[model samples]
Target: MKIFNCAQFVRNLSIPTLKFYVAQHQLCPDLMIDWSQPEKNIPKALFSDIRRLEAVQADELTSLEKKQSITLGLVRWQDDLKRTFCMANDSAINEFRHALACDPEATVVFGAGSPEDIALWVLVYREKVFRDAELHLAFQAKTHGKYWKQHLIPKGLDITHDQARLDKFCEEVAQIYQKVGAGKSSHVEVTERAQDGSVQVTIYVEGPLTVIAHFEKNQFNRLSTRIALETALVYHPSNGIVESVVKGGAKNHTAVLELFGKHIVGQEITPDVVEKKEFRLNALRDEMLEPVLDWSKHGVHKVRLRRAKFTPVGRAGVSFQIDVPPDMDKPDAMEEAKENLRVRHYFDAEYAMESATLIVYMSPAQDGKAEHFSFGIQRLGASTIKNLSSKNQAIAYEVLKALDIIDVLDGPGNPVAEEQPESVS
Candidate 1:
């Protein structure tokens, strides 16, 4: 038997919200007290101190005070929950209670330590509760099929056809903006436009700037999209094509073209082809001009640059990674890369082993936290400087200087400064 734990159900429910459930279900709850009427339900003898909440601000109350109030208030809820569930219909009540437990609303209430937290919690709780209610209705529809699909489903009016309703709704929306000091709205237009076997919605806004926006048809449904994809590959992994679109512009045209040619040229673009294709292989490479020059300028020709990728590291920084088969596939690749990369690699093989292959990260130093750049620069020196030779160290230092992580000395004989950390990274 699936035992219904009614005591557990009412433990964290908002009392005022519970009233909606009670009235809707026709429940005769006894001990539970609503948030608004805490005094009405609880006895005068019980929670005498909590009853003084009327004089004190709930949001400003101390932690101990809130704990005392909630602890006493829960006592009443425990008694009421048992009584309410005992009288309520077994199946329906249990389902609703299960939904409440599963919802994020109750989870947030327990997680909240203060009134400010509870305020945000309530907003989240209410949103999730509405969604949970919709889910419950869906469950009800499975058993009550015919009635659920017909009578229970109220027909909604089309916005374009119902001018009066649309006007009234727009007026209310405008009033809401005015009431909240969001300024007045001019008007709302909902006209449909047909172009190239596709429907485009025209939303005309007569406001401060008279702005207009558009939403295109779903790609698969549009004629132009279909025609453009006519020679598209036999649905091999679409990641490359998708990535090309994401990257955009003329720069990625060759990669996009090659990717499509490799995948599509002679193959099908059906659903089954898409399902059968594998996307485990590496993405097509693009040799960037900037990093190629950086490598040439570095003058470290021993470790041949196999492939290079420069990715945006943080808000305002770039991470340049170069893969050298010689640097990686060696028996002591890590040791070799580290020793050759940093001037200090000879003194610390462990540092070389840790920093090798990861290369350098060029991140913007936070204001007043530029001091930490020394540590990051030290890490790069461990991983980035390939050789202790005069020319090689100069090249590595040049790269580090450009990133603003370290200062460049006038000559190669000048020693690099020691690092310091003052704040959290």
Candidate 2:
């Protein structure tokens, strides 16, 4: 059958995604963890177990083509692999979340899983979940041609009976599209009306993982259409990943006929929204222009504010500049670890809490084996983080005032006075 529509594309792509992973030697056959789960507290023993199968680099996904199943596997997580058994799982996601709760400025957390196995999956978790689920439903449905005839229109072209409907839909999609950013980091947005009066959205994103998916503006009765529409969504802010259609600008999706329903346009350049879809279009377009982009592959440990001078206008941005030291390539694992921690201390000591402004001060090095330094800003993406604790907020506000990121609008909000060194270092 000639496949044409976005739904057909998603349905075709996702139906066999799981069977693809079955061929890989399991790290732990006792466990049945999927792409949705975080890889934390994973056993150290799995390193050798995983390394023997395929050289799964950090955040790497290997897909072996199969006639029936889409065989795929995420490789081992990177860093401290030889020494640490506590790699990935629920514990790590939670532990990191808690630390950020206590110290929003803790710089140790954000860069925890640069190229971990779960990194690729978690980065695109939402994209996979809904698409996988929808494709599963499409695989299940065997609709009668009459249903397609009723929906396909005045001319008797039953959509479910032939591939022409898909072709027509795909053509319609090509003519109306928008992109917020350019490159691998950019998100391709498309919106279309279905025969059942529901609007669907297709977002194509290329990263360490490739996600091309579609969904409803909002949930509609499944009986209304055989396609399975999602009723829930989970948004993860790590690196500003957008998790739902509404988050992608699908407000009032059920209303239909809304032009440019999904666009990457965003107004808030505030630190909090910078990673979001709207703002990402402006800042990270070219970064994602490729098929694979990640820390292990790119040499960028993290993206954080290195230096900024605030003004009434938008915030200034500089490279956070974290890197492996030139000498870190030493064969001595212990020595390498010590060097990693030394780099960590340099930045973590200054911005102890994980706040939006907390810099990921890796002190950009020429390059080496040094483990990257992280400040747990990713935890702030938790929906639970409503506002900074009064104390931390005050602290952050003071620091922002010092940096002049924000003006001292009132009493006590003023930048705290600091004593200067007797002489320059």
Candidate 3:
């Protein structure tokens, strides 16, 4: 039995959004409350229903009811938006109750039993109405993370919205997941496809986990630990561009590309092309790095170059990483950093910049609460934009493209050069 602070959760949500979610989900059909006038009576009615449900002890629930509850819990927990909404609502309601209890004049409403315990269960009912809902906009408002971009060459395959072709692609993805030790259960589905033939695919893998110890109800307990991993990819066949937001590491990313090549393209991507892409940013690092440091013109403030990594020409094994302190704003810092590397014979000719990490501060919805977005750019046509809203992500991408940081594509015209040994100075 999990305990939730039901009162706190309800208080935090905008009344309109809560009303919308409740109405959309039909959470309390029996209450028969008028949703049109939610501000006047909906919150009170919702609390009463939660209290009644919570009064029913776990032991009193029938076997079928218990099973249903577990199933519903698992489903809601897996979704990003529903889980967030429930947690937020629960926290807000609990806080509200606490405030009321502390106030001498305000009477605390002690309905019955522990209503907080069943709050989440009540909100996330058995029905699967929200599975296809547009809750991403709401979820994005609450959380943030990094998104990585990559490019893929479709070769012979013609990208389309054909159902049979998409099903075949999903089958190949499942096979690839098995080969990569991802899991035996894998689901691949097309989430969206644009008019230009670019497709957004989502891959989910489930695997069993081993835990040494578990604790529940203040007693020793053992529970099944099955975890699910998700990866999102958008492939543009027109230009052979693929952008991925992966949930795991390099192996998972490699598995996705391998699936796309072997199944869709009908040809395996060569090791050289698969491993390295044509990234011209190294050659234009000096010209681009400075301009990006001052992004006030793009509506982003306090943009700073935090770190830069450089690999020596003809010496792939040797590299230099310079960390720029926040207070250090010297224009010659990069040059001086390279000069220091020359003394150690690590700077051959000119240091070819490989990657850089930049930190930018911006506010979402102009709410005055600025979030620190730290993003990294690799010369190998990969860039990571982190902790940004959807609008800010577009702005960041535009800024990077305008500066030629991520313009190079993975294609045949730009072949990877063989490495050579550096001559002794």
**TM-scores of the models, in the order given:** 0.16, 0.22, 0.51
- After TM-score superposition, the amount by which residue 422's alpha carbon in candidate 2 deviates from its true location, in angstroms, is 39
Candidate 3: list runs displaced more than 4 Å: 1-10, 24-52, 55-57, 61-151, 155-172, 176-185, 193-197, 205-219, 229-233, 243-303, 306-374, 378-382, 386-425
Best by TM-score: 3
Shift of residue 328 alpha carbon in model 2, Å: 19
lDDT for each residue of candidate 3 in 159-267, tens digit (9 for 90 to 100): 4456666566666665655554556666665532222344556666665454546775368977766565566665655655565555455655677677666665557
Score residue 37 of candidate 3 by CA lDDT.
69
Winner of 2 and 3 under lDDT: 3
**What TM-score number comes out for model 1?**
0.16
Question: Which candidate would rank higher by TM-score, 1 or 3?
Answer: 3
**Candidate 1: which pairs clash?**
233-264, 234-268, 340-386, 340-387, 341-385, 341-386, 342-385
lDDT of each: 0.30, 0.26, 0.48
Q: Given candidate 3, what's the lDDT at residue 29? A: 42
Error of 1 at 55 (Å): 73
C-alpha positional error of residue 280 in candidate 3 after TM-score superposition, expressed in Å = 9.4
Number of clashes found in candidate 2: 40
RMSD in Å for model 2: 21.5
Q: Look at candidate 2 and tell me the lDDT of residue 269.
A: 20
Return the lDDT, model 3, position 147: 33
User: How displaced is residue 356 in candidate 2, in Å?
Assistant: 15
